[model samples]
Target chain A: MTGNTAPSQADARRTVISVDAMGGDAGPAVVVAGIAKSASKNPDIGFLLHGPAEELEPLVARRKTLKGRVEIRDARDVVTMEDKPSQVMRNGKGTSMWSALESVRSGEADGVVSCGNTGALMALSMLRLRKLPGVNRPAIAILWPSRNPQGFNVMLDVGADVRADAEDLLQYALMGTSYIRNSMDLPCPRVGLLNVGTEEHKGRAELKEAYALISQNAEKANFEFVGFVEGSDIPGDIADVIVTDGFTGNVAIKTGEGTASLLRSAIREAFEYSILSRLAALLAYTSLSRLAKRIDPRRVNGGVFLGLNGTVVKSHGGADATGVSAAVKLAFLLAEQGFAEKLAARVASAVELAQDDATSADADAPGDSETGSTN
Target chain B: MTGNTAPSQADARRTVISVDAMGGDAGPAVVVAGIAKSASKNPDIGFLLHGPAEELEPLVARRKTLKGRVEIRDARDVVTMEDKPSQVMRNGKGTSMWSALESVRSGEADGVVSCGNTGALMALSMLRLRKLPGVNRPAIAILWPSRNPQGFNVMLDVGADVRADAEDLLQYALMGTSYIRNSMDLPCPRVGLLNVGTEEHKGRAELKEAYALISQNAEKANFEFVGFVEGSDIPGDIADVIVTDGFTGNVAIKTGEGTASLLRSAIREAFEYSILSRLAALLAYTSLSRLAKRIDPRRVNGGVFLGLNGTVVKSHGGADATGVSAAVKLAFLLAEQGFAEKLAARVASAVELAQDDATSADADAPGDSETGSTN
Candidate 1:
C-alpha cells in the first residue's frame, strides 16, 4: 500500500477494474480467461474478480498472466438471467453483481464490468452507485458500429428506462455526447434525436420539442445538433450520437443485432447451398472474414452505463472470451482516461444550462400548457 | 359497355385498380410501365389511369398490353411529394390523387393505387373512402420479408398515425388479422404487440394494458395472441402479424430498410476492395443475386391502407416497373377476394365485442381510469 516500494507512479495509478465473474451464460472460466487475455495484452490492467472464491481461485491460478494481475473477492450469491430488477433490488445483497458494483462504489475499482441481467445490474448500480449530480435519469450508452470516421456511433437509453420525455431526451443527448466525446475522443460530436422521419414537423409532439431543445442548446453543450434523423441514420455517419427513448432504442438495438445475426446466417447458408458456392466461399473467405470482423458484435461488446457516479460496462450475457476481453478493453480505456469524472462534470454544467433554458421558456410561454407538459 | 364484349363471366367481373400516374419520383413512366407489366401478366386486371391525358396518352400508347386493359381518366393536376396532408385536405380538388381516390369512392375501381405522397394519399383515401364503421383509427399495413413459411409477415401502422392507445393497438390487431387472413390465406394468424421486451411486465403502461386487452380478445378475434414481440420478430417467423404504434413501426421499418441497404452496400464494397475480391464476387455472383432477390424490397412493394371502406395500396414513390407491378398484383388479389368488405365486417364484429368487454370492465373496475384512458 506504501508508495515507497511501488514500481512507478504510472504503475501505482494502474487502472483496476471490478469484474463480476459469475452469472454470465458462459461460466466464470470464460471471465478468467478473458481477463487473462486482457492482462497479457495490457500489463497496466488489473482486475478485482468477484465470485465464489472456491470456483474462481483455481481458474485465476491456472492463468500465469492473470496470477499477479488479478485479485479474487468472494461472493456466494448469483443473479440469474431470469431474475427481475425488482427482485434483485429487494434481496441481492451477496450476489457477485452487487459486490462488483460495491467495489466501484468504494473506489477500489475505477470501473465495474458484468455480464449478468441488464435490468438487475442497472437497478443495482442505480441503487448503489447513485446517479451523478444533475442527472435526472441515468442512460445506458452503447457504441454501435457505423460508417463514421470514428467507426462507431454512440446511442443511449437503450433500455435504462422505457420512457424518455423531452427533458429526458435532452439529457440523453447531452449524456451521449459526453460518452462519445470521452470514449471516442471526438470533439464536438454530432448529436441527433432519433425519430420516424427526418422532417422537423413529423413524429411525436415530444420529439418536436426535443428537437427544439437540442437545437437551441447544441452550441452551449459544445456539440452539433443534426436536428432529426431516421432509424437508418443510427448506423450511418450522419450523427455521431443517436438519442432516443429507451423503448425505441432498446427495440432498435435488438432489431439491429437480430438483423445482423440473420444476415450472417443467411450468408453462411448461401455459401453452403452448393459446391460452386462452397468453392467461391473459400476463394472469398479472407474478404468475408474482414467484413465479418467489421460487423462482429463481439468486437464492441460493452454497453457503458452513463450518468452514474462511476463507469459500469455491461458485457453481453453470452459473451465468450473475445467478447469479454473487448468489454474489458473498453473499461480500461474509460478508467484510464477518468471518463466518469469528466462526463459527470460535463453533464452537471450542461444540465444547469438546460434548466435555465427551461425556466426562461416557461417564463416566455406561461400560457402554453403543452410546453408545461413537456416533462 | 364492359359486359357486352366480355370474353367470359370472370372478365365481366374484372378488378379495376385506379392508378395515380403522376408525382412519383420516376414520374408517370414507371406507373404506366408497371401497370403494363401487370396487365400483360393478368388478363383479369384493369386500370383506371389518373393523370394528364396529354402526358399519359403517349406513355400508354407505347405499351400494347395496356391498350385495352387501361382506361385513361383526363386529370390535369398532380399531387407533389412535398404537399402536406392538411394542405391536400383543404384544396386537393382536381388533383390526380384526389381523382384516383374518387374512382374507388364511386365504385368505378376495386382498389386505388398511387406512387405519390403517402400523407396526401392517406388523407385523400381517408377523406373520400372514410374509415370503416367502428374503426377509431385506420392503419397502413405492409408485408415485410421474413423467415416465415409464407415468406412475409404483416406489420401494420407503418406510418398511419404517430400514436396508438391500447384500444388502437387492439384494432390494429383485428384489422391486421383480417388483412393477413385474407391475403396470406392463414386461418389463424399469430398476432403480437411490439414492445421493448417480450416479458409480461415490461414496456410502457399502455403496452401492459394492450397485452391484457389483446389477450382477452384473442379467441374472439380468431387469432393467436403471442403476447409481446421485440423488433426482431418483425423479420422473424415468431409472429405472423406484428402490431405497434405508428411511431415505433415507422422507425423500425426505416431502420430495417436502412440496415439492409447499408449491409448490401458494405458487401458490395467488401467485394470490390481488390482484384481477388472482385474475382471472388464474380464467381459468387449467382448465389449473391439469389440472396439479393430474397431481400429485395421491390418484391413486396406495397403498403395497404387498412380499416378503410375501400382498399388502397400505396406504392413506393420511387418504384420502378417491377415495384409497381408487385403493388398492382397485391391490389388485384385484395380486390378479387373482396377483402375490404370482409375486413369491414370482421372489424365491426370485433369492435362490438371489444366495446362490450370494455363496458363490462368499466362496470366491474369503475375506479381504474388508466384502462378507460385508452385513446
Candidate 2:
C-alpha cells in the first residue's frame, strides 16, 4: 500500500542498507536477488551493494524491482569464509565487507548486512564503526524461534568473543535489553542470565557475580531480571532475552540448530515411510508447509552485532536469496527504528549509572572501600 | 528367551542393580514400575530397591515380575530434589540415594541406578566410591541419539563439574572411548573435542591445548582423534565421542533437548491444524509412531557417571516407567560387561602412558623440561 505513495516522497525517505554482495556462499547474484525482493516488498528500501562492479552490476540490472533503488559500490576484493579475523583486520581495506561497513561508518547507509565470515565481519565492523563507549565486548545476538508471544527470544554473545566476565555479562544484559526493545518492540524485556540451573547457588563463580550485577541493574536498565535460566529456557516462554558468554551461547545456538535439523529430516523420513504416509503427506501439505515456514532458519537469518556504533546484521554465509532477504528486512527494520544510536545512548547512560552507584557506595563506605575493591 | 533360563541358575548369576526408589518426580511407584519392566525383560537382573521398607514393599509387590527379583532396603530419609550436594555429602548417610550407592560401594550391587537429585547422587557417589586413580574430575556421560552407526554419540562432562582443564578434557576423551567400547561395542571410538569452530585455532586457550593433548595421545590410547568438532557435529556421524567442559556440555545437551521438544510440539500442532491434517495424522499413525520411537528421549534416559570406582546411571529425575526401565537396562548391560573395572584399568594405563611420554621427553631434553612442565 505504501508503494502507492508519491515516488519522490518514497525515494527521499528510502532507508539504504549497505550489503557486502560478494561475501555469501551464493555470491553476488543471490545478494542482488535478495535486495530486489526487499525492494519489491517495500517501496522505501534502497541498497548500497558492495562488490566488484563488473560482477554485481549485471546482477542488479537483471532485477526489475531494483532498477533505480540500488547503487553498486565497486569493491574488488572479497573476504572469503576462510579468512581469519586477525588477518582480515590487517589487509581488509579493499574487501567488499570493509567497503560495505565504510558506508555505515561514513553515514551514507543506515545499516549494513553481510553474509561474510562472521569473525572477519565483526572484526572489520569494530575497526570501522567501532565499539560503543564503556562496552567491553560487542555481542552477536540472534533471534531463536520460541514459545514466546513474539514467536522468538533474543539470545546474546552467540560468538563475538569466547569469554565474558561479570562486568561484560552485565553489559550483555543491557545490550540484549536494548536489542529486544528496538527490534521486537517490547518496552521492557525480561532478561535471563543463562546458567546450568535456575538456582541462585548453581553454576560458576563468574555467573553468580553476573547474576547479582544484572539483578541490581535490571530496574535501572528498564528490563525485568528473570534471575537464572537454564539452556532449556532459551526456547521457552519464561524469558524474552537469554544472556551468556559467547562460548556457551555459541555452543547452545549451534546445538539447537543441529537438533532442529535432525528432527526435521527425521520427520520427513516419517512422512515418506509408507504409501499411506506418503498419501498423508500430500493431504497435509499446506499444514506442513505452514509449520516449515514458521520454523525456517531462513526466516530468521540475521545475527545483529550489538554494542557497536552502527547496526550490522551478519547473515548466514550459506544463505540463499530468501535468507539474505530476511537479513536485509531485519537491517531495514533496525535502521528505521534507529536501533544502533538508541542502543548506544542506552548503554552510555547505563554505564554512567553503574559508575555513579559505585562512586556513591565508595563515598558512603570510605573506610571499607579497600575491601570493596576486592570484587 | 532369557526368562526361560533355569531360575536357580539365573539367581546364581543375576546382575543386581541398586536403585533409589524414593527418587524421581513420579515418585517410588514409577521407580518400582521401571525395575519391574526391566525384571520382566531380563531374567538375570535383580534390584536392590532402596527406600522406606513399608512404603516400597507394597509397590514392588504389585508387580508380579518383580516378586523374586527385588530386595527392599529400608532407608528412612529421602533425598528430595532441593537438598544441596554439599549438604547431602555431609548428612546423606541414611538417605535412600545414599543407601543405593552404598550397595555398589559394598559390592552388594553390580551398578547403581538412581532417578534422584543429580548433584546429590554425584556428590554421594564421589564421596563413597571415590574418583579413579588417574582422573582429576569425574564426568557425567550421556548417550545422544545421533547419525552414528551405534545410533548415539557419547558426550562427557555434561554437569559433573562446571570446569575442565586440558588434562581433564584428555581424561574425558579416554573415558568417553572406554564408554563407547563397553556400551556400544566400538573397539576404538572417534573422539572430538567440542569447540565453537572445528578450526584448530578457533576456540579458547584451554581448548587449543586440549586439542594438541588429545591429538598426541589418541594413537597411544587406541582411539581415533577427530581433532575439533563444533556443537552441530555432536549429532552428526563425524565422531562417536564428543568431549567438553561441563559448563558447555551441560548447556549444549539441554539446548538440544529443548530444541527437539520445541520442534516436536510444533509438529503436533501442524498435524492438528485442520481436518485434513488430522485425517493425514490418522493415516500416518504407524509411520509417525516409528519416527517418535526413533528419537524418543525416554528410550535413551540414563546419564552415566564416568571416572569413578563404581558405575552409576543417573536416570532423569522426572523419568516414567519406560524411562526408568531404559536406565535399568543400561546399568545391567554395563554391570554385565564389568564396565567400571575396565574403565579404571583403561584410565590407569592411559595415565601411565602419558607419564611415560613426558618422562622420556624430559630425559631427551633436560634443558627444555622446565618449559614442558609449564603446560
Instruction: State the DockQ of every prediction.
Output: 0.52, 0.65
Question: Which one wins on DockQ?
Answer: 2
Per-residue alpha-carbon lDDT of model 1 for B67-165, expressed as tens digits?
667777878788897788899999998898898899899988899889998888888888999999888889999998778899889998899898999
**Model 1 residue B167 CA deviation in Å:** 1.0
By TM-score, the best candidate is 2
Model 2, range B273-344, lDDT digits (tens) per residue?
988888877877787798889879999999999989999999998899999999999999999988898888
Docking class of 2: medium
Q: Over 4 Å off in model 2, which ranges?
A: A1-10, A361-375, B1-10, B361-375
TM-score of each: 0.91, 0.94
Q: How high a TM-score does candidate 1 get? A: 0.91
Candidate 1 - CAPRI tier?
Answer: medium
Which ranges of candidate 1 are over 4 A from the true structure?
A1-13, A354-375, B1-13, B355-375
How far off is each candidate at the interface, as Cα RMSD in Å? 1.4, 1.1
Looking at model 2 chain A, report the run of 10 residues with the lowest lDDT sum: A366-375
- The lDDT of model 1 is 0.84
RMSD of 2: 5.9
Error of 1 at A282 (Å): 1.5
